[model samples]
Target chain A: MPSDSHEIVTQVYAAKKDNKAADSFIEAYMPFIRSETAKFTGRQPSQSDDELSIAMFAFYEAIRSYSRFKGAFLKYASVNIKRRLIDNSRRERRKLGVVSLDQPAGDNEGSSVLSEIIEDKGRPYDELEEREAVHQELAELTERLSVLGITLSDAAENSPHQKRTLEACRKAVDFARSEPGIIEDFLRTRRIPLSAIAQATGESRKTLERHRRYLAVVLLIFSGGFETIQEHIIQTLKGGAER
Target chain B: MRYIVAECHPAYAILLDENAELVYAANLHYSVGQTVESPVLMETEKTSGNRSAIMHTVRRAAATAAACLLIFGAYRLYMGSADRSAGSTIFMSANASVCMEINNKGEVISVKALNENGEALLSGYSYKGKDKATVSDELVELSISYGYISSGDTVSFYIDAPESGVYDSYRTELLGRLGSYPINTDIQKYDSSVQVRSDFTVSTQATSAQPETAANSTQSYSSMTETAETPAADTEAVTNSTVSTPADEQQAESAYPYHDPETYTGQSGEGNENWHGSGDHGYWYEESTDEEENESSTSEDTDQPYNRRHDWSDGYGRYGQDDDDEDICQYSEDDCDTSSESSWNSWFTGWSGYRFYSYCEREEVSECGGTDICTYDTGRDSYFSCEHGTECVQPDDTTDETEETEKTENMDETE
Candidate 1:
């Protein structure tokens, strides 16, 4: 019930995503980022005033790329701050026994060195993606889903949406399982047809028509994607026969 | 990897290869990594807990990754939400990203990024650069979703009048207010942007809107406030629980055979968390019954009330259900948008603390469609991450509805 920050964050972001303007935005928000970063105090290296500076750069980039797809800018920016902070900590630890030197009042060593190091490390533009980590995260997620007695097949087979679309569909399926009347109530209350579901789910109507046959076994399967699985089986069997 | 004794550690410890020339032999310290033998070892100390812990962490991560690949034979899968409307109008929603900065000057500010639980996502690393320092690990990967007419509206309703002109320009705005994460003590701010590329088939009647203020507010309030309005759902729930008359029994009979709809009468889940145990269907294109079972399984947990139908009572439709009573200022005119605009949107953007925004310059240039179209239409529990904490790497207390209500009440009393 919190007042939505989505509008403000999204608007500010959309209004200034240009790479050319990234610097000005970064400069204006530098103070705010410094303040937010400063809140970390003892946790960060002692000799680092550049914390705000680094966080600002990240914030600027975040401003450029934030979107409705991620929910709200507040939520997204908070995540960004944490990420930048962690990297800063890691880099500082790698330095001399200073592990991480907290910047003394007048010492400029921290910022200069940090800037030099950051510049050396280069842009992580494409490195942001860790295929291995993502894969691991996915496996862990599906494993958790499995604990509920639902297999990936039982979940994803329900709808043939895109990979991301499949993720959304799975959430819907997961929610449906926890609620008692969602399935019947959804159809009756919203007047949404089983076929119309293809929009969110990219499943074919023909596939849906075929799978509507077993509305009971789904309980045994513990997932909503039985129809999709059935269609797969049918296709496989036909293919096997053809071979 | 050459061994060199650097400044931090005393005696013969490992020295950074690059810094060797500068600190080469400031003291009698030998290079850090090469030879384990050194006089400094005579007064050595015990290994610290910090080093061991970091090593353990690396080991655990490697093990987990290996185990995952062995067992599941697949990688991580990120699910996206479809309860979208922000991109219904302007700017192409190309992508969404989470970014951070790194430099020596930046390390001091890293702590604020941690979730209340104290976990860091974009941790950093060090390397040398040319002209300027550029931190790498602090990544910001964008979630770029292109909204194309996946499938046109099949059940088309006739546009009453001379609604002409193709949809050449459109913009969308999204303001999420689902409150904090598991570790976030304070409410985390979520930023959302939406862009849609449309090929609008046009009709002739110039689309016009009839702005009715009082009625519009009430109607908008009812529609926008419907999901957030706790009373409506609570009343339905109460009606459902008390309906035990003979007529009610007959009504139950008239209700769904699979689900006793009338037994609960008008009992709609208002403040309750909406769950995977849906009232109707899950994402499966067809009803395979298994999906129904899954739905029933998750529905029994009472912890989540807003899972089914969330009440926007926390705040109005302005931005969210709480705190923001003053609606977001409406900026429907083009002239107002020309001032100081960011580089992303075309200087024509505005936000008044809530969840609404307007892009077109002139009010008369294009009549607002259904000027009073104020209903929030997407299922509250539309994603997997919300229900089982699947994709939530870190969560917060306000992430749930029960705590939000308690907090809201506490704040109200204080005020």
Candidate 2:
């Protein structure tokens, strides 16, 4: 199995420079690609399935661009396969005349589809609601950030660049979540409880101060009713922990 | 290089790149599933960028100022200590003695008077902003104006500095400045090992006399008196002479007439014996004789009574006139023809105890022909007016008569 993984990494590397190697590498990862598509489609992807074909194209694209910096070749190919399948689903939804969940539903002037619709078990609708919730949460976060003289762009720039520093920031967010007083103070003052976070998490005051804006945004997402935004951060942090 | 728009929001879009990484970029009105290159990603805010740039510039400026302060502080520390120990001290002596402390640049920092005459000489003088040479020249000019120095008198300089080069430079500069003056200039390096005598006693009577000539006459008389009295007693007399004479007088005596009798006596009590027995006596005697001659010649030209008294005393002591006290008194009466009555009386008053008695005996036996009886009476009264009390009269008693004869015999043998 190790040899197979090693062979896949070598093939992906060669494929980055040559198209024939990309095709060959994509063919080799067909099972992994179908499995990723199956996870999205909830079934085996037949050869005629356009999702299957899209997943294959995504795997080929992954091979054409893959480098050692991208981590395991199989995991990278799987992510590309899933992304392409999602893109295909959105493209089909567009064909079905659904512009965006954020847009008003059926000529309703001030109401979004997400506000008007009931909860549905349909995958597209569920995805639409999740995206709509994320968009709403992001809008709410943007407004709250502006009150603190911060912008989403400033939050992104002030975000810790190093993985360890990012983890430290996540730890600060978790500490703020556990300590209700910290969240209340942060909400009332619209400022990060920098010294409190540093003292509780054993992180340096300098590091916390450097990422104060980003920490404020993340703590707001955790402490407020911004569930969708908070989930995004949790997923990313989980991914980081897994790595 | 290519990203497919997976999800679009009001603020940003989640774009799926070929690397499978989801990136948040600014939404430029893009539809989902649209493949695009060069989408507007969320860039750093203009305010944050400007703030960072300003902060960077502030940090750099603070660092530069700190470096400049550190360099300046270190420079001040180094220069402060260097300035503390960098100066030279100049000791200038005529009859007036002044000490000038100078900096490395030769500028006088302070002037201190070493005697009362020096204080009078420097009363109206200011050394501010003047260099060593300028200050020395001004001081010399002041001494001349105060009559502390004359055409034939010597103005001696002693320089104490951190380096010999400083001494030499100061000497050269002072010589160049005072070379045109009529007075003689004597410059020498000062040895700190030799203890400087600050308490210099000058007689008001001889203030106008040449300091070197008067000092030589006094030192010769003091040494002769010391030798005539006791060899061990010479130390106290030499110390008294050293303390009473001006600094230049002591220096001249040390350089020519006498080697520091204190140092010689400190080595052993036989200092007087070594002083006379050593070949140094002839050179010293010759130098003293030459000084007396020069003093006599200048006295005739200048009409100084102090110089004539010095000549009389110097000749009396050196020619061993104590052997025939009667003939010496006759000679003093004959010399009174050339000097004023008061000067002659004052000269007689300055005589030693033995000579005072011999002069009294001469006045009793001989008629005061060339000299008046009042002159004799004045000398007798002045001699007895000293605070010595009965000690002044003890020399005439029988107990001290043997001691006086012994001193007279010692004086004859030394001559």
The lowest-lDDT stretch of 10 consecutive residues in candidate 2 chain B is B382-391
Q: Write the per-residue lDDT of candidate 1 for residues B345-394, one digit (tens) a residue.
A: 32111222221122211111112211111111113212111111111111
Query: Candidate 2's C-alpha lDDT?
Result: 0.52
Candidate 1 ranges beyond 4 A from true positions: A1-11, A42-50, A64-79, A87-243, B1-247, B250-281, B285-415
RMSD versus native structure for model 1: 38.9
Candidate 2 C-alpha lDDT tens digits along B21-132: 3455545566665556865443222223455446545643554455346546755864553343225667786577766656656777566565567667777667777888
Output the lDDT of residue B99, model 1: 17
Q: Considering only chain A, what is the TM-score of each predicted structure?
A: 0.33, 0.49
Candidate 1 structure quality by residue, lDDT tens digits, A63-164? 644544456665676677667667667766766575332334335644443433434454454323332333343344345445544433233223222222
> Cα RMSD (Å) per model?
38.9, 46.6
TM-score of chain B of 2: 0.38
DockQ of each: 0.01, 0.01
